[model samples]
Target: MLAASLAAGGFTADPAQLESPLGYFALYGDCTRLGNVLAALEQLWALRRHDINVKKHPAWYFTQRTADAALRLAERERLDPAEVRSIRVTMEPGGWIR
Candidate 1:
């Protein structure tokens, strides 16, 4: 499901983290992990020239920036909306460069 959703373009990963009663510590911890993953993905792809569209994916304070970046990348790649099945994110929210 995750693969399918990623393949599709412009799907929202709304409500990134903090939407649930998961507590502050856990939320921030999860945000860190999400940031790490996003950084690694960006590095892997040389998104130096890609054009990305951002639509304001929702996020708690912890994951806002990273979520925004992810959305941007997803737009830049022009992911196949039909193929997208899932996204890794918190219930609360939503980037890119190249």
Candidate 2:
């Protein structure tokens, strides 16, 4: 719901989303290590009619290879920069930390 609202331009993302390293990592992690987070994000993206600039709004979770990709997307899209979600053990070494 929150992610949708942000994408729709209805809500400004929390500055903390961008500022907090923990929050940043929490939302956008590797799907391989965090499949559930990725899946939920995919579903959220699918809910909206507009095209989410995958470049602008990144997967949030990124691998070493995708670090630059995430940064570029953050600069361009700035979507849900502060939105946080609860954890559901969707990934290993997990619990929710956002």
Candidate 3:
């Protein structure tokens, strides 16, 4: 419906195109497309304040928290970096990048 509206408004695009890697990145390339997307969202009443827990310094806060937790866990378990084989860090989808 959003795509249909956008197309009627002269901004034709396959909504599923954004699911592709290149199409996903293409979203950030055009201001017109971005504005059209916002407008479509507004028309569909899909735009809202979903992020209730806003942070002032998200990057710094998360990085510091992660470091602190890792250090505490390592100390508690007597983990030696030299003896450690691998370390895995998981992040929420889209959180791995900007």
Candidate 4:
């Protein structure tokens, strides 16, 4: 299930770590890891160029930014909602990018 959670956020997890939470903590402790992961996740959103960085904006603006980005990306990618298995719109709460 960890793999699937990572995939939902547009990340691929190591198979060897499938059963171990420690695999996560070790990678997470690296200073460069989060930025690298966020960069990878941005590729999944075709509308990234249009969306506001929610963290930089007011917290109340989050829902609108997320919904707009999802709609735009879905349209831009010519996505079929029925066939789409996963789409990530929200950042993890308190998950700082800086």
Q: Candidate 1 vs candidate 2: which has greater lDDT?
A: 1
Model 3 agreement with the true structure over 1-98: per-residue lDDT tens digits = 66667878999667757544467536544424556556655653343442224344334444555666778899999999899897777655555453
Q: What lDDT would candidate 1 get against the real structure?
A: 0.55
lDDT of 1 by residue, 1-98 (tens): 56557759666554644334474425544434556545644764434333333345443345566667776877999888688898775443322221
Please give, for residues 1-98, the per-residue lDDT of candidate 4 as tens digits.
Answer: 66667789999657756234466635544323556546655775634753535453334444556766777888999989999897655566864443
- TM-score-better candidate, 1 vs 3: 3
For model 4, give the 10-residue run with minimal summed lDDT.
Answer: 52-61
The count of residue-pair clashes in candidate 4 stands at 0
RMSD, candidate 3, Å: 15.0
How well does candidate 2 match the true structure in TM-score terms? 0.20
Ranking by lDDT: 3, 4, 1, 2
Where is the poorest 10-residue window by lDDT in model 3? 49-58
How many residue pairs clash in model 2?
4
Tell me, what's the RMSD of every candidate?
17.1, 19.8, 15.0, 16.0
Any runs in candidate 3 off by more than 4 Å, and if so which?
Answer: 1-61
Q: Give the per-residue lDDT digits (tens) of candidate 2, residues 1-98.
A: 56776789866667666335566545554333345545656775553533444443333443323455555666787747576253222343432234
Best-to-worst TM-score order: 3, 4, 1, 2
Which regions of candidate 2 fall more than 4 Å away from where they truly are? 1-62, 84-98
What TM-score would every model get versus the actual structure? 0.27, 0.20, 0.33, 0.30
